[model samples]
Target chain A: MTALKAIDKTTINIEKIRADFPILSRKVNGKPLIYFDNGATAQKPQQVIDRIDHYYSYENANIHRGVHTLSRDITIGYENARAAIQKHLNAANPCEIIFTKGTTDAINLVASSFSKRFISKGDEIIVSVMEHHSNILPWQQVCEEKEAVLKVIPINDAGELVLDEYNKLLNEKTKIIAIAHVSNTLGTINPIKEIISAAHARNIPVLVDGAQAVPHLKVDVQELDCDFYCFSGHKVFGPTGIGVLYGKEKWLNQIPPYQVGGGTIKTVSFEKTEYADIPLKFEAGTPDIAGTLGLATAIDYINEIGLDAITTYEHELLVYATEKLQKLQGVKILGTAKEKAGVLSFIVEGIHPFDIGTILDQMGIAVRTGHHCTQPLVAYYRVPGTVRVSFAFYNTFEEINVFIKGLEKAIIMLK
Target chain B: MTIEETEQEIIDEFELFDDWMQKYEHLIELGKSLPIIDTKYKTDDKLIKGCQAQVWLHSELKDGKVIYTADSDAIITKGMVALMVRVLSNHTPDEIINAKLDFIDKIGLKQHLSPTRSNGLVSMIKQMKMDALAYKVKRE
Candidate 1:
C-alpha cells in the first residue's frame, strides 16, 4: 500500500513522459485529448517517429537481396532490429524471430504451418473462451480444413480461464494450445506459464499471444518456455505493419514455411526450390524495413524507461481507476480477475456502451466501447459490449480523474 | 412537410443549442419519442447491424409514399434513427430518392453517424432509399 502511494504520477515526472508523445498535447472536439484506447494501439512516441523519418530520409533501400551498398546497409539495420527484438524477448537466437504484419499474421503463420506439420483429423487445438478473433479464427480455419477439433477452455465469471477445463481438454488428441497471455477485454493475465508447462508435459507445443502482454509486461520467451510468442509493434508504441513471432529453434526449423517468395528462397529451380533458414523462411516478399527500424527504436525507448517502472506506475493507475469507477452506482465493472492489467471495462445500468463512448468522445476522452474483438467472452457477460479504458505508462492520475468525470457526464447525457 | 423543409426545421432546432450537451439532449429526446416498431417486424432481416449497436428498421409504402419506422438498442443512435425517419418518411419515391439532407453536418453530429462508424443510420438511409426504389419500380 505504501509502495502504491510511492509510485504516484509525480514519481516519474508524468508531464515529462507525456511530452514524448506529441499527440498527447493536442485537443479533440475542442477539448484537451485524453486517449484511453491504448489497448487498441498505443500512440507513437517522438523518438519512434524520428527514427522512422531517419530511416526513410537516409536509409531507404530494399533489404536481403540487392548487391548495392544501400541494400547491404539497410539489411544490417533490419536484421539488427530482429536482434534487438530477440534480446528484448530473451530468445535464444535471432533465427527465432520472424517479422510479420502483426499478431494476427503471426498467429496465422503458426496455425497454418504448425497444423500442416502436426495436426490431423480428430487432433484438438485448445483455445480459451477469452481469445480474440485473431487467435480463434486461424485455429478454426485449420480445424475446418483438417477435420481437427477445436477444444475451447472455458472461463469462470471472474474472466479467468478454467484450468480444470483446460487440463481435461489436453489429451493424446491435443496438438497445440494457442492462447492470449492476457485477455484484451477482461484485462486478466492468464496463468500462461502454468498453461505452457502443462502442454509441454504432454509434448504438445503452445503459442502465446503476447500482443496484450508485451506492452504491459516484460516478456521473456525463453523463461516462458512458450513454443511460439507473438506481439504487434503498434501495441508497444512502434509503427504499424510490423510485428515479431518468436519460435523455439526446433519448432521453427521443423515446420515448413507458411509463405514463400523472394526472401524465403535460397535457390529456385522451378522444379524444386530450396528455402532459406528459420526467420527468412516465413517472411515472404519485401518486409516493412522502416517499420522494423521504428519498432527497434520503440523497443529501445521502453527499455530506457524500463518495464519495471512502467508496470508499477500502470498498476497504481489501474487501482486508482477501479476504485473511482466502483464509487458510482449503476456502473458495473467487468473482468474482476484478482490479477489484471491496466484495463477497466464496465457497463452502466440501462445505458448502451456506444452511447457512453459517443458522449465520452464529445468530452474529448477516447475509450473503446464494443466487444473488443472478443465477442464470445463479452457476450458471456450478457451485454452488447463494454466501455473500456486501457492505460499506458504515460497516462496520469489527472487523466483518470478527468475520465471519471467524463463518465459521470456521459451517464447523465445518455440517461 | 417536404424533405428539404424538414431538414431546415431540424437544423434550426439544433441551431438554438450553444453546446454539444444541449444538442445531445435534443437527440435523446427525439430518440425517446421514436415510435416502437411492431414486434412482428423486428426480425433479423429487418436488422441493420452497426459495428457498435443494432438498428431494426421497418418501412412500408402507402399512398405512393414510404412510411418509415425504426428502433435502436442505443438511445443516441435511436435519436439519429428518429431523425432519419422524420426527414424522409411519408415522401414520394422520387422525393425520397432525390432528397439531399445536409442537416446532419449542420448539426455537427456527422461523426456519430459516419459510414466508417457503422452507426446504422447511414445504412438506414441507404435502406430507406432502396425501399423507395422498390416501391417506385413496383408502381412503374
Candidate 2:
C-alpha cells in the first residue's frame, strides 16, 4: 500500500544485505532462522566481525599511552571511532563523544555525575514510564541519594507520553528531563525534538536514551539539541560492550568525572588529582579497543547502506507486520502510537505470551517474550507480558510471512 | 509403578509423535486433563516463582505418600506441570524426593522448551521436591 511505496527499492538490495550477516544462514529446529529479536540485540554483519577479528589479530594493544606501533595504531582506531560516532550523531565536537560499556553504563555515568552537580534535596528529575530499567534505575538511585523527587511522565492508553502531563511535571525545581527517543518495547518514536525544545525553553537539560532509536532512525543530536544522547553499539549491528554517549561540551564540562583512573586523569598524586579533558575524563581504565573499532566499522556499514534506506525499509516491515497481525483473530497489538519504529508487541486473547513465544521458537522464530525489561509498562497494560517481534533492515517480507504462519499455529495450539 | 517406569512410559508415549507440533498437541491435551488445584490453596504463597506462566502448587501427605495438585496460566506449562505431577503424585515422600524425572530429556521436551520455560520447569521440580521434603519432615 502507501507505506510499501515509501520503501526505496533502488538503495537496498535485501538479499545481498542479508548475506553480510553470517548468523542469518543458521537453522533452528529444522527450520531457517527468522530472527525478530533485533530489539534485544541485532545480528552482526561480517564487516564488524572481521573488524574485531582484525583488531585482535594485528592491532591488539592498549591505547593512548604506549609508544609502540600496535598501541599507536589501536589508539587511532579507537579515537577514530569516537569521531565516527560524533559524525553519526552530528555532535559539535568529537570530545563530546564518551565511550562507555553500553547504554546502561552511559546513563549511569550521566546520572551519577550530573546528579552530583545538579540535583540537590527537594529537586525533581523527570523520566517517562517507557524507559528501560537502565534509564529509570540510575535516576532513581540519584533521586534516593540526593533526596530528590523522581517525577514520571505518564503514558496514555495508546502508549504515548501525555505531553500535557509532562508539561505540568516540568517546573523550576525540575533539574533534568530524561526520556527514551524510541521505546524498546512499544516502538513509540518519541517527539524528542519537541520534548528537548520544551525542556530548553525552561532552561532544563534533557537526556535522550537513543538505544532503540539509533538502530532504526536517523538521529542528529545537534539537530535535536538534546543535552545528552546515548546508545549501545550491539543494537546497531556492532560488537557488544561498546556504546557512545554524546553530551554537549558545556554540560560535560560542568559535570564531574564518572570514574578516576590512569586514562581519565591529567595529574594524580597522594593529595591532588586533576582529570583529563571531557571524554578521557569520563573514560576510566582501559576501554574496549576492539569493540570500538567494530562499532566504527558498523557505523561505516550503516552509512554505506544509508539511514534513509534503513528507515524506509524497516518502516515498510513494521507496517506489513502490523497489518498482518491486526488481521489475525484474537490478536491485540500494543503501542499504537502514530509514530513508531522497529518493534511490534502483541498478545493473543486467552493465550499466554510465553506459550506463543515457545511455539514460535519451535518453528525457528526468535521473538522476545516477557516484559521486555519494561515491567511498569507491562503492568500498565494489565497483561503478563507481550510477544515482541523487533525487526532490522535485513529482515524480509518472506520472514514476516513465516512469522505470521508460526504465530497462527501457536495461537491455534494455545487456544 | 516405579518412578523410572513412569518416566519410561511418558518417553514411550512421546515417541508416538513424529513432529514437535503433534507432541505439543499431545502436551496440550495432557495440560487440559491436569487436575485443578483447590481454590483455597491458590494463594500467592502457593504460586511458583521464576515461571513465565503463573503456576500454583499444593500438596498434602496421606499415609506417608505426597499428593500434589497444580495449575498453570499457560497450557504448555500446565502440561509440563501435569507431567511432573503424573510421575511424582501419590508417591512416598522419600520416593518423590529421590526422583530424577529424566523423562523430560528422554521425551526430548528439554530441548524444545525455551531457556526461560526450562528454568520454570526446574522451579516446578524444585517446588515439588520441597513439598515432598516438607511432608517427610512433618511425618517424622
Candidate 3:
C-alpha cells in the first residue's frame, strides 16, 4: 500500500508488503510458513481476497445481456478490468485482451484458434526445451492433429537457450514460435524481445507464455511486439481460474473463435449467425467475472509497489540464496543463466529431491521438487529432478537462512 | 509373525521417535534396508512414475508365499515400499489380499496416501494387491 517511489528500490518496506499476505503469518507444520513456492503460485494478498468478496457481495450479476442496474454497473467494472489489463501490457486495444481460465487455457486458446488460420499439414511449432508443459502440450496436440512437427529449441549447460539452433529451425514451414517469457523451473528470463523481432522478420507469429514472467517483470506487449502473450492471474497474487491472452489486432482478426457459447454472438438464427469481434469472439459462456475483478485488484496492488522495485528486490534475494546454496557442499545449482529470476533449483549429491522436499515441508519451508511439469527439461539436465525454491517480493533474508539450515538438516539425515 | 503383528511393530517403532525429524531419519534407514530388486525388473515398464518420485515393485511366489521386492529413487518412497514389504511379503495371497495396511496412517505417513501428492505410493499399494490377486487366481 506504500507508494514510496522516491525511496531506494531494494529498501522498499518488506514488512508492509509481507503484512498484505495473510497466509504468510500462519504456521504449516508447527513452524511459521517460509513460502518459497511462488513459481507454483503466489499467495493472495488481503486486497485481492477482499476485492473478490466485495464483488460477490455487492455486484453479483450476469454480464452483457441484462438491462438491470446490477448488470450495467458490473459490466462497466468488467470492461474497466479489461482496460486495466490492456494498459498493464500496453496492448494496442482493450479488445486485444481475451480473458481465459489461466496461462494453460490462454495457450490452448491461441494454439487451437490460431492454428485454424495459420497452421497446415507438416508446419512446425517451435518451442524451447525449458518451457513448462503448459507451453508445450497444446502445440504438441496441434502438431499431432495436423501431422505437423513440434520442433524444440535447445539450451546450453547454463540453462540459457541456444539462439543459433533456434535460428536454424526457423524456415517457411515454421507456423508458430511459442516460448516462455521466463522458465518456470530454471528461472531463466529468456531473450524474448530479440526472439520476437527475429520471428517478426520471418512473418512468423509468436505466443509468449508469460505466466512466470508477469509476476516478477513488467511485460509490455507493444514494446516486445510479440503477436500474442498469455499469463495467469493466480501466479501474480490474484485468484485462480482467471487469465488474459493479449493478441495483436491483425492476428486476432485472422484467428477464429476458440470456444463458442451464448455471450459471443452478434445475432443468432438457424440460417446464419454473425459473431462479435476479437475478445468476445474468443471468450464464450459466463466468464470468471469475480476472478477478473480480483485480478484487476491484484494488478492495482502490484502497480502501487511497482514492478521495478520487485525485480530489483527479487534479484537480490535470488543472488543471496544462490550464493548460500553454492557454499553448501555437494549442492549443485541448476540453471545458472546470467539473467535469471527468483527461482533457484538445486540437487544434492546422492540425495533425492523428494527426500529433501519432504524434510523441508516438516520444517514449514515449502519448495517444489521433481520435474515441475517440465519433464523434458529435467530429462535434458539428466538429473532425477530438482529441489526448487522460488522466491516472491515478500520472502526475506531470514527465511533464506532458515531454509539453508533446514536443508543442511535434511542433508545430514538423508546422508 | 502375522501381518497385524508386523503392523503393530512398525507403529511401535515409529512411536519411539520424539519428533518428525527422527521419524524421517528412521524412514531413511528403512529405505536403505529394502531388499534389492532384481536388475531385470528395473525397466521403465515396471516403473510406477510418481510426479515427485518413482517406485519399482516386483513380486514372485516362493513356496506358495508372495515375496515382494522393491526399489525407488526417492528414499521416502523406498522406505514406504519397505514397510509395505514387511507387512505383505512372505504371506499367502489370501493373507496379502485381505491385509488393509491402515498402519500407514497410524505412523503419520498419510500424506503419501493421497493421489494428489504425486508420489505414486497409492498405485504401488494397489499394484501389490493386484499381484496378490493374480497369484490367488492362479492358485485356484
Query: What is every candidate's alpha-carbon RMSD to the true fold?
Result: 1.5, 1.6, 2.6
| TM-score, cand. 1 | 0.98
Superior candidate under DockQ, 1 versus 2: 1
Higher DockQ: candidate 2 or 3?
3
Sliding window of 10 residues with minimal summed lDDT for model 3 chain A:
A1-10
Which candidate number has the best lDDT?
Answer: 3
TM-score of chain A of 3: 0.97
> Per DockQ, what order, best first?
1, 3, 2
In order of appearance, the predictions have TM-scores of 0.98, 0.97, 0.98
lDDT of 1 by residue, A310-411 (tens): 888888889989999999879999998888886889999999999998889888999999899999898799899999999999998899999999899888
- Candidate fnat values, all: 0.76, 0.68, 0.76
* Candidate 3 docking class: high
Candidate 3 regions exceeding 4 Å error are: A1-11
lDDT of 1 by residue, B73-121 (tens): 9999999999999999999999999998788988898786566654677
lDDT per residue, candidate 2, A50-84, as tens digits? Answer: 99998898779999999999888888888899999
Clashing pairs in 2: none
